[model samples]
Structure formats: structure tokens, C-alpha cells
Target: MSGFLPYGRQTIDASDVEAVVEALQSDYLTTGPTVARFEEAFAQFVGVRYAVAVANGTAALHTAYAALGIGPGDEVIVPAMTFAATANAACYLGAKPVFADVECDTLLLDHNVLDPLVTERTKAIVAVDYAGQPCAYPALRAFADRHGLALVADACHALGGSLNGRRVGSLADLSTFSLHPVKPMTTGEGGVITTDDPDLAERMRVFRNHGITTDHRQREQAGTWHYDMVGLGFNYRLSDLQCALGLSQLARLPVWVERRRELAARYIGLLAGLPDVRPLEVRPGVGHGWHLMVVRLIGACPPGFRDVVLAGLRARGIGANVHYKPVHLHAYYREHLGTHPGLVPVSEDAFARILTLPLFPAMGDDDVDRIVGALEEVLEDVR
Candidate 1:
């Protein structure tokens, strides 16, 4: 009650600290064995054959786009509701991003809208797992296969999330994850690209580190410093120190996900009868990571109701916030793509009413109660 409860936060413990400390004390801090080890562990955990650690999620997306041969004149279909990186990756390749509206309830790309969008230039579909719930991969896969297009899952918010017992990363041709402090796990601003395709994985590996064919560790094992610059690439490698932290964090991922699920259930039960507020729908067969507990304000709410609720939560020492505005509504997209307000009605509608409340592993029943109490007060005052 005294301190500000954040919308999301990293739950670091002694093991995480020790991992960082050990890395700091070790010989290699940057581009070292730890990064590879972390990648291997992550790949195994996600049921993927390979994983490439990078500087951040945006870099992961860019690398994946480049690796899959998406470039000038190509088009990638992306959900309008996701983070900009899902579409910006295509821009990085000098390709255009074709925006598709999301499902009304799940806020994920509607596969029904996708096929019509695919043209002669369409190269891939970047399906985002919005709010930690996996997209309908089976349907997406079928569509991608019919068009001979790649399927990339921008799973930055869904590391521990899955569908029908199949992990998120393994479901797509390539999957990317973010390790920012507020995500399901943290590596203090790091990311990893997972894939079953060895060639694509190798491409991402080289691309993440200045297009170098062999990394420092590989050179050391071969007793030579010589390496080849395979192609044009960016300096997007994750440090060993970050990977060390990630490895420790990965060990706690299961419990963290479970706790998040519990918290989400508590919110559902608490707000069940509330008329003006509704939780986002989670489709059956998918395990939501609950990275953000988003609730939508319903009919007849004041125009400034969201802001009022946010201010009231802050006043009560809670850190509630909105996830995002529709990506196509941003200035750059409007100017470049000529995207307008009605382009993605579902995403635009969700943006107007959605609020992300505090939901982290560190929260307890008291925290949950505090948030609910504050929300109730704000709703009544605004109504």
C-alpha cells in the first residue's frame, strides 16, 4: 500500500544475482560460452533445434526477417495490434508490411483476413502472440503452406505460453522472444530467435554478430582468430552477463508462469460481475502467459474514463498502464502506408478501452486486493 505496485516487474532472486556475479568474475563477459549455453538451454526448453541470442526483440525480428530472405519488394502480413517490431522488421528489409485486423476477442491476427491480403509480393506472415497467448498456429501454418510463405511468431510476450501442448517457439518456422525486465523472464534487455531450420538459424547466428561466420568461442576452440564476414549484418549480439542472468531466470520460468495464471484467475473471479469492465478472452487450447492483465471498459463510460482510472490507480500507488496504440495509427505508418483509423477496427476499438493492470510474480493476495479495490473506487466515481 505504501510503495507503487508496478504493472509488471522482474522477480530476481539470489540465484539470478549469483549468475551475474559469476559471469562478472569469469574470463569472458561478452560473446562468450555463457551466451551459447543460454541459447542451447532456451532452444531445448522451447523444443526448437536452434536459438540465436541477440541484443533485443526488435533485433531478433530483423534478423529473422533477413534470414528468411524477406527483402526489397516483399510484403509481410502482420497484426495491426502488436508492437511495432512485428511490422518494422519488414521495413528493415526494405519490404512493405501489410496490416491485417485482429480477432475481436483474442486480439490476434485473423487468419481469415490473411489469405485475401496475400499477393504476388507476400513473403511471410508475422503472427504475434498478443498478451502472451499463442496465435492459432495450425490455421496460420496451413495458410503459410498454401502460399509457400514463411511463418514467424513474434512471441516476445509469450515465452512460457503454448497451444495444444505444443510450445510457441516450436509451432512456427521461426519464433522470437524478448527478455526485457517486465516480460515473463528477464535478461535485462536481451532476446533470442528460435527455429527448427538449421540454415535459417545459422543465418540469424551470423547476422546477430556483424555477419561473422564464426563467433569468438568457435575461433578459440579452433585455435585461430580468423573468421569470415559472410554478409552485411548488424552488431546485435547479447552479452554473456545478460545470458547468465537469463539462464538463472529460465530456471524459475515454470513457477512464474503458474503464479501469473493464478493471478489472472483471481482477477477473473474478482471482476466477474462487473458490468463495465471485461477481461480479454483467452481461446481454448492455449496457455496464456498473463504477461499483462488487460481489462476493457465497456459501454457508456466517459471519454476520459481510462485516463481517470489510470490516474486514480497512480494516486493509490498502483502502476497501471496501456499496452499500446494500434501500430498503424502511429505517425510513421500513417504517412508511409497511408493507414487510416478504420483500417483495423478491432485493434482501434481495443486500444480505446484497454488498460494493463499490475500483474507480476511478486504480487500476493494483498496486492491483488489493493488493485481491485482501487479499480472499483475509480469505476464508481467515473460512472
Candidate 2:
């Protein structure tokens, strides 16, 4: 309570510490039984047949794109509101990323705006569950079916969410997750990809391990040291130590998600008093995981009002931040992909007003109250 409250952070417990210590004490630290154990647990949690763990989320994205055969000349439509990694992964696979606009209210990819960007060369749709809210998957799935394009989910922000009783990982052909410290859970640094197709699962597994057909443990057990590099790949393996942490964190995911939801509701209730603050519109039947608590400023708030609020909150030991600046507006994308400001109008406008407040399981009622009080004071000064 005395220190700065960050916008997002991992909540580690004694059990998490014990699990990591146990992994360190084990005979194997990396590419061992623990990795498979964590993957199995995660797959079950996500209601998927297979889950491949990797070094990090970006690696998971790259592996998913590579496994799906997305390469040069192929286009993958993604929302401009998401982290750059969602599109950068396509670029890594030599594919062209066609940036798409997000809906003004939800800050999620707008298929109405996205469908026009599709072309004969479009190979996939990388639907990101921005801010932990599941995308419009039912519609997106039908569109992918019509176009014969792969549907992948950048679901790092939505590990515990669902849409119409279907879990996030099972919603798409291939769904990717992150284990960064600030996410719903942490493994120090790791990621996982989920898919029901065995072929895609195998391809992603090989893609994470330098295209090697079999892991070292498999060769060692066979007593025959023969392995082949079947396809192009990289060393994206997550260590047993990290997997141990992930498994421990997974056990607490449900409670953590519920806590986030409660905190989000409280923020909504509190922000309602401030007429100019507006929470994102959550569509019906969508199970939001609440990775971030974002609110848009309304009612003729000054042009740089969000910036003033951020500076004011920072000065008061509250670490508020913006979820994103539209990906296409970034310098690299503008220079390399010929993207411009007006490419996605709604997202660009949202970026200017959006402000992310702290929301994590570790925070209690007092924390929320403090953040709200700080924000109210900042908003008053801005007004």
C-alpha cells in the first residue's frame, strides 16, 4: 500500500516459490518431464487436446505462424489495438501483416472493418482477445470457413475466458498464451500454444526446438543417437523451473480470474460517478478475463487530458498507463508496411482517450479505493 501500484503485476505466493525450488532441486531443469506435465495441465485447463510450451509469447506466435505455413506473400489480418507482437510474429514468418481497425467501444478487432482487408493472398486471421475479452469468434470462425484461412487467437490476455461455453484456447485453430510476470499468471517468461489437430501440434513442437524431429530425452531413452532436423525451427523451449511456476499459477487461475472480475466491477461502479469516464462495452455472452481495466474519457475532456491524469497518478504513487498506441501508427510499421494514421480511425481515436488502471488479484478494496481517490483528484484538476 505504501509503494507505487503498477497497472499490472504477478501475484506470487509461497506455493509458487516452493514449486520453483522443487524444480531447481530436480535432476532436470529444462526440456524434461515437468514441461510435459505443465503442458498437460494447461491443455486440460483450456479444454484442448495439445498444448506446446515455449520460451515466451512472441515465440509462441512465431511457432504458430510457422506451423500454419504462413509465409512470404501471405497476409494475416490483426487488430491495430493489440501489442505489436501479434503482427510482428507474422512479419517474422515472412508474411505480410494487414493491420485492421478495432471497434470504438471494445478496442477489439472489428470484422466489419477487417473483412475488406482480406484478399486472395490472405492466409489467416490472428484474432486477439484484447484486454482479456474474447473476440467475436463465432462470426470470425464462419468467415474463416468461407475463406479457407487459418484462425489463430493471440489469447495471452485471455487465458481463463470463454465465449458461449467454449474456452479461449479451443475457440481457434491455434491459440497462443503468454506467461509473462504481469499476465494473469507468471512463469518468469514462457508461452503456450493450443490446438486440437495433432499435425499442427507436432509442427509447433518441432518449431520450438530447432526443427529437431525428437527431443534429447527421446533419443537418450531409445539408446540410439539419431535425430533429424525436419523443418526450420528455433530454441524456444521453456525450462522445467518455469513450467513448475506455471503449473502452480494455473492451480490458482480460477480464483485469480474471479478476483479480477470483482475488481473490474468495483472500478466500473466507482468510475460511474465520474461522468466523463466510460468503461468499455462488454458484449453479451462474452466471458471477460479482465487482464486490464481500461476506461475512455468522454464529454469534451481536453486533448491531453489522459496524459495529465497519467502524470498526476504517477506523482501520487499510482502507476497508470495506456494499453497501446495503435500498432500501425508505430514508426517501424509506417516505414516498412506503408501504414498511415487514418488507416484505422476508431483505434487511433481510442488510443488518445484510453487509460489503463491497475487490476490484479493481489490488490484489495483499499487499493482500489486509493486508485479511485487519486484518479478523482487528477480528473478534478484536469477539469
Candidate 3:
């Protein structure tokens, strides 16, 4: 039998280990030089002017929203199909997250639906790079500009992706990335926000360091023991150790993304002849980062058939999993936001059918074949 396959995993090597060890022996550990180095390198990679390191992806979102001055009575439009953290971050700052429906094919936020959701209270449009595919940024950008709303890219799933030669991080007013074990890269657990706006970057830097005017490094460099608290903030600082690993991992990202795309294409080709299963459509001009290799059951498949297929795959050690339940359908959102079953019909419909297959840089072609073989068996069993 083949070994168990996880939906995703980190691709660590000896170099990554050495980098962390070197940082451990360095003079500064937390939020120090290595963190700044990682931030700078990441900014260059994304073609952004500034990048601010943070504790996690959710912190990146919260800090970005806060930097945009999102506050009480403000509303931030979020795609209904993303991870809850996308919406939860806005709520953390006392701003409402208005859930928007996604396109049926890509599960990306549909720009067509934004017109009815916009209101005077809308402060920003947080577009998620769902499954590592870049959203239709041109359309979304035009809409945000017309409505006087700030555009934010929740690009945690799309770190290395590009659209028409423009990188994902440079596609919005502010862009966020997650360097989790399962993502395109790993810092163990870290996040970074990228932007061209200097003011926004500085705000995020201060916000991550307990809202203090200067961090320990700055104070020490100036040979002063003074610091000032400008506002309330969380200790959302990414450690130097994490950043060290991040630098090593970041160096490997381009190669890794290429590998991911190759694997995704292999899956697409292997599954092409399968009945009632189809991979999400990739939009033209998109250089998909392929964070998740998602497929949906179609036609004659029953409403709950996705869960059954997921169970079958897992039972066979395939490690298949669902990408998400729509944010509005989650119990917390249902109660708190008064969201109901049919609130976002397309999202709810997609949620019932979609499942994420295992895909990572370290995975081999045979692994892809094994997964597809298992899926084929699962479908055959149901029939």
C-alpha cells in the first residue's frame, strides 16, 4: 500500500535547518535583523516597496485592516468562500465583514456582485486569492476605485502567483501572505504584509510591536532606553528564528511554485477522463500558485456526495479534505451575523461539492497517480 498523503505539507531541507540554527546563535532573536531581512527580501520578491513581518496570516489581515483605519461602524467586503480569518480580522477591529459571493468556476469573489453589497460604510474590499489563483484584479480594482474603497488582497494562498506579468502582492493597495507549513513556503508559522504605501507599512510595523513608536532594536541602536506607546496593539511579532527559516524558504519559492504548478497540471491531466469530477477553471493570464489542488463533483452527484468521496479517500489513506464551508454558513457567522443557509447561494452550492486533493512540491508524479487511482476507485464504489 502507498503511504498516507496529506492535503499539504512543508518542504524542508538541511539548508532550512541550518538557517534557523544560525539565527538561534545570533545576537538578536525576536523581531530583530533577520525579521527585517526577511521582510525586505519578501518585498523585493513581490515587487512591493515595503513588507512588514507578523506573527501569523490572521495577524497580517488584522494589522492591514487596522492600518487602513478600519474601525467601529466600518464595513469590509470579504469573499464568502475564504477561510474565516479573512472575515474575522475585520471583526477584530470592530468592523463588519460583509460577505460577498464568488464566481461559480473559480470560486473567486465575483466583481458583478459587488455593486449591490457596497454602501457608504464600506471601508475596504478584501479580495482573497482563493486556491492560489489571482482574482480578476483589474475589474476589482476598477470597482474599488469607483466606490472610493481601499483594495486589500488576502493573498495568503497566492504568494508567488502573478497576473499578466504583475505579481499578486503588487495587485492591491495592501497584500498579505502566509508562510505556514502547508502554504507555498514555510517560516514554521509567519505572515507578511506588502504594499507600495510607505505610511501603511510604517503603521503595520508599529502595530506589530505593541503599538510602540520604536522597537528594541531601534532604541538600542540609538543608545537610548526610551520608548513610547502610541496606541493599543498586540505582540504580533515574527521572531528572528522564524524569519531566518523564512529567508531560506523564500529563496526556494520560485522553484517550489513551479513544481506545484507541474503537479497541478499532472492532476488535471490524470483526472481529465474521470466522470463527474472537474478541477476549478484557471482564469486567463493567471499564474496560479496552486496552494490547493481543488476539484468539485458535478452533475448526477448528490448534495452530500463530496463528503462521501472525502471519507472514501481518507479511508484509503489519500488524506483528501474539503477546502471550506462558506464563511456565512459557519455556526459562528450564522448566529452573529444573522447569516442563513441561502445567503450566498453559489458559495453554498460550491461548498457542498468541492474537495482539496494532496499537492505539494515534494510530491512525486507517482503520488499523483496513486491519488487519482484512489479517487477513481472511490467514484466507482459509489456507482
| Model 2: ten consecutive residues of lowest lDDT | 297-306
**lDDT of each structure?**
0.90, 0.91, 0.93
Q: List the residue pairs that clash in candidate 2.
A: none
lDDT of 3: 0.93
Residue 14 lDDT in model 3?
Answer: 99
Candidate 2 lDDT, 126-208, residue by residue in tens: 99898899999988989899889999999999999999888889999999999998898989899999999999999999999
- Kindly provide the TM-score of model 2 when superposed on the true structure, using C-alpha atoms: 0.98
Deviation of model 1 at 337, angstroms: 1.9
For residues 1-383, write the lDDT of model 3, one tens digit per residue.
Answer: 25899999999999999999999999989958898889899999999899999999999999999999999989999999999999999989989999999999999999999999999999999999999999999999999999999999999999999999999899999999888899999888899999999999989998998999899988999999999989888899999999999999999999999999999999999999897789999999999999999998988657778888999999989999887889988898888989998878999899988999999999999999999998999998986
Per-prediction TM-score to the true structure, in the order listed: 0.97, 0.98, 0.99
lDDT of 1 by residue, 1-383 (tens): 34999899999899999999999999999988899899999999999899999999999999999999899999999999988888888998899999999987788889998868999999999999988999999999999999999999999999899899988789899999999999999999998999999999889988987898988878998999898898999999999999999999999999999999999999988888677889989999998888889898888655676888889889889899987888999999999989999987888888888889999999997788878888988888867
Model 2 Cα displacement at 186 (Å)?
0.8
Q: Is candidate 1 or 3 superior in TM-score?
A: 3
